[model samples]
Target: MILDIYKDALEYSAKDWKTLVILGVMCLFSFLLLPVFLITGYNYRVINTAVHGIINGRDPLPDFEDLIDMFVDGVKVVIVQVMYLIVPVIVFVIFAIVAGHFNGGLSTALMIIGGLITFILIIVACLMSQMGLCHMAYNDGAFSKAFALSEIKEVIEEIGWSECLMTYLGLVIITVVIASVVSIIIGAIFTVFGISGFALGVNASGVFLLGAFINSIVSMFIVGPYLSIFNARSMGLLYTMQI
Candidate 1:
């Protein structure tokens, strides 16, 4: 399944090289409003595609068709994520205000408690959000489906909670490793060749700034989408197990 996840994303991107590059370029310039929309739209499409792939027993990184649908689904997903995270955000905000307003033993205690609670809530939210998104996908992008706790729990039970959690953690670790390696390689290349050899000769500050810029390009153009596809494929596989 892991190999399939990697192969699916790799083959899909290879086949859609032109489209992927175009999207990557768009993401490169995503400081503009339109590009931001398209980039996010693409992300939502990934989730949608994962949903379809899971249901169909094949991991397909969807194409860049159905722009309006992708955009709308993407917006809905963002909303779903935000809504799931609202409680944690509120808790942190309140604790932050409290910690700021009052500085004492009581304040210190509150801060510690808040920190622990916030951390727990964040973990729960992450797990819940993934299941919720899968539920939403299963239900044809119906936002309300994400909140169907009983049904979601049943699906989780079918998959086995421990198994699901381990799979998720493993996937997270894999992605982090991939991203770290990509960053290290890109940084080394630019720092050694571009910065040390050229940019630093011109301007030290510019060298660092240029490294950051190039890093963003490599991240968006290659690493980011690759990880996104990999994630979607893995999640789809998880969902498939339940079915």
Candidate 2:
């Protein structure tokens, strides 16, 4: 199933360059602010507002003064997402009913299981991607890897359950500490020069934008490929452990 998804992605890549480019652009537009938050400071509301603006076709750019205003607006976005969760539940129920009616018995059960697994895989993939990105952002050498079954198995075997949990926790803590320190240093430099100083002297905003662009590049070139490789490695590790 995991390999099938990778194959589908690869086939999609080969057949749909235009779609890929559009996807890349959309991802860039939507997530460009993420690194900024990491580097500056995290305000959940600020992050929410940025995501809201991107989704709503509003300009997501922050003027220094509007930052507070945007943060305030972010709360509303959170409420909206909470409300939207109901729609998915309704859709899932409807689909399950239809499947039961048409297929019944073993086929329906298998279909349900497949859907569950697919959903789980997607969620795991996203979590792994986030973890990999955080690791890379802090360590520079930590590349993004795909959360393949093989990779998952490898992680379980080499690290074991206990060690895996500890490693992930450690990584999270380290990422937060590093990002905090970087933000403080950058903030101090900006303060010394002032916004005007920033405007005149290589603007912190420019640096922020450049870092986002670099991150996108890394995601595409390094993270995406490494994910595929890691998935295979994880499977191998899992097999070895099982044996």
Candidate 3:
């Protein structure tokens, strides 16, 4: 099932080169801020499509129309993410306070326990947010549906907790490996050329050098958006599995 999800996601992302390039351009201009919303909005469309397509059959990547609606959906996506993040933040703050009240070995023990608990909470928050985004898409962008924790939990149960966690952990692992490889490649290019200021993305001329250009090209147009869309498609398909 996981293999099929990835296979479908990869093919779906490349179904239309024009749409893919448009997404890439949006990512390239994402620093402008407005494009960020559009990018997120597009992701929402992909997930929504994936969920619905489970029965109706998959469609090509969604076209970039309806800018206003996309922006609103993007905002909802961000809100859902921030809402999920709050759980871990609250847990961390509480742990800090409780740990502060203790001293000596007890304090040390409390701190370690708090750290572990916080780590687990962070992972759980991330997993839940993924489901929350899918749930929001599954429900036609209902703002409250993203926060429907009970519904989300029930969906996860239907998917089976172990399978869900392992799938997410696999994503995390793959992401880490890709990021590490990109970093190493960038570092090697910088080191081999003995380039200075290239790493900073500009020199006295204030122009992008080889390293920065490659990094920007890879991140903005290539790897980053592909991964984002891929993730959305994968999770959306996973959400459909609950059916």
Query: TM-scores of all models?
Result: 0.79, 0.25, 0.83
lDDT of 2 by residue, 131-223 (tens): 332222223222222223355445455536554444334434444564456556655554554566576776467655555555556455433
**lDDT per model vs. reference:** 0.72, 0.39, 0.80
Q: Give lDDT tens digits, candidate 3, residues 38-134.
A: 9889999988998887723567788788999999898888878888888778887887898789888888888788889889988888889989988
Better of 1 and 2 by TM-score: 1
What is every candidate's alpha-carbon RMSD to the true fold? 3.7, 20.0, 4.5
- Residues forming the 10-long window of minimal summed lDDT in candidate 3: 199-208
Model 1: CA > 4 A from native: 1-15, 54-59, 97-102, 194-211
Select the stronger candidate by TM-score from 1 and 3.
3
Clash count, candidate 3:
0
Error of 2 at 65 (Å): 54
lDDT score at residue 104, model 2, on the 0-100 scale: 47
Residue pairs clashing in model 1 are none
Candidate ranking (TM-score, best to worst): 3, 1, 2
Model 3 CA lDDT for position 14: 61
